[model samples]
Target: MHDAISYLLFLVGTFLAAGVVKGVTGMGLPTVAMGLLGTVMPPASAAAILVIPSFVTNVWQLFYGPSVAQLIRRFWPMMLGIILGTVGGAALLVRVDPVWSGCWLGVALMAYAGYALIAPAFSVPAALERRLSPLVGLITGVVTGATGVFVMPAVPYLGSLNMSREELVQALGLSFTTSTIALAAGLFAHGAFQVSQLGTSAMAIVPALIGMWAGQYVRMRISPKRFRQCFLFFLIALGLELASRPLL
Candidate 1:
């Protein structure tokens, strides 16, 4: 049917755009995809579509970095917390109305956009990282499970660690990968992840990969700082748009 074709086209386009953002800025695929797709689909369904692409892309990003073992050893507590929180939050997602989820998603996007605009540069003391990492991880995981957007206190917390650019990117990949996997598991447990959805999610990887390649090419030619500012502004607009949906 025409409607089916149109929906597929939209899915491809959404993932492609999301992939480009991730490739250029090292994050935002799920956030962007969920924000756009949730307009047409349930939040739970949008989250289902994200599982495979997010996992694959983030794993690629994770292995691209050095010292994986060291990072794992350093961040295990946080990882564990993410798992626990996602399991709990996914239960909440299943119980809540989809409209409420959309509203939460909108608020989350707006908050993250506001933070990105401010762009603070700060560092956590070494002692604090050990104490706070799990807490941040738990919060990010709950957000991820409920809204399918996982970059909250976690990203900012990682940024606060004052890592080199490459390390930061790799660390983010690790965190995202963990979140994606946990989210998938949560969805599966809740019976929201149907086999057909898995197939669709797998197919989505191709467009995402293609867009990532294209975005990398663009990244080579432009100032990332400028591009990021533009992207943040766009996200602000998107957040506003999504937020207005329930109100209107």
Candidate 2:
């Protein structure tokens, strides 16, 4: 796997694909990278490859997105839940089997698909807003911490809120930031985190960021309806990948 040709092809293809997804969606670098690598590599290796890239891309969003303060204030309810949930998910990492962990990831992706298919509209009910917001965050955090892929329960709930584009960007940025930090810590605890992977992950960051930035430009050109269609399509694909992991 570490031979020159295989390594070169993996880096180039995965980097470009990850970047394209991020550029268009404002997130998904890790999802795309992990999905592509998961075809061949173990889940841990897939996750390890994206660590630096994920951290860098989220950092870019955290600093560059407009209206951070307003978004934080408005979204605090859900954010708090994410923090708590992430802690629980991270703890589960030590206790759970890797195969089961993979299955949990599949559940998250499938759940996201169901949500996207049935309730594409993001209008959260006022009652749900009061009760469900924190739970959504917790689920997002836990899934993120244990699985290294966070597509489900968290993103769908957040997507439902009536956030302006910039505010949405900020919320996602913060969520990913918390999750990444937790994931890094867990990997370190398991002796999976290494200085060598840092360099490789850093190298992968270039294409991932480029793809995301380019996607922003294209996103601006697309109308709202078209954008949503594309978003849902991507979510479906992500879901299938997760659901089929055992067979693969």
Give the best candidate by TM-score: 1
Give candidate 1 misplaced runs (Cα > 4 Å): none
lDDT of 1 by residue, 1-248 (tens): 99999999999999999999888888989889999998998888999999999999999999997868888998989998898898779876666788888878888898898998897888899989899989988998899888888998888899999888888888888899999999989999998889999889999999999989988988999998898888888888887877787777
RMSD of each: 1.0, 3.2
The per-prediction tally of clashing pairs is 0, 6
Model 1 TM? 0.97
Candidate 2 has an lDDT of 0.70
Q: List the residue pairs that clash in candidate 1.
A: none
| Total colliding residue pairs, candidate 2 | 6
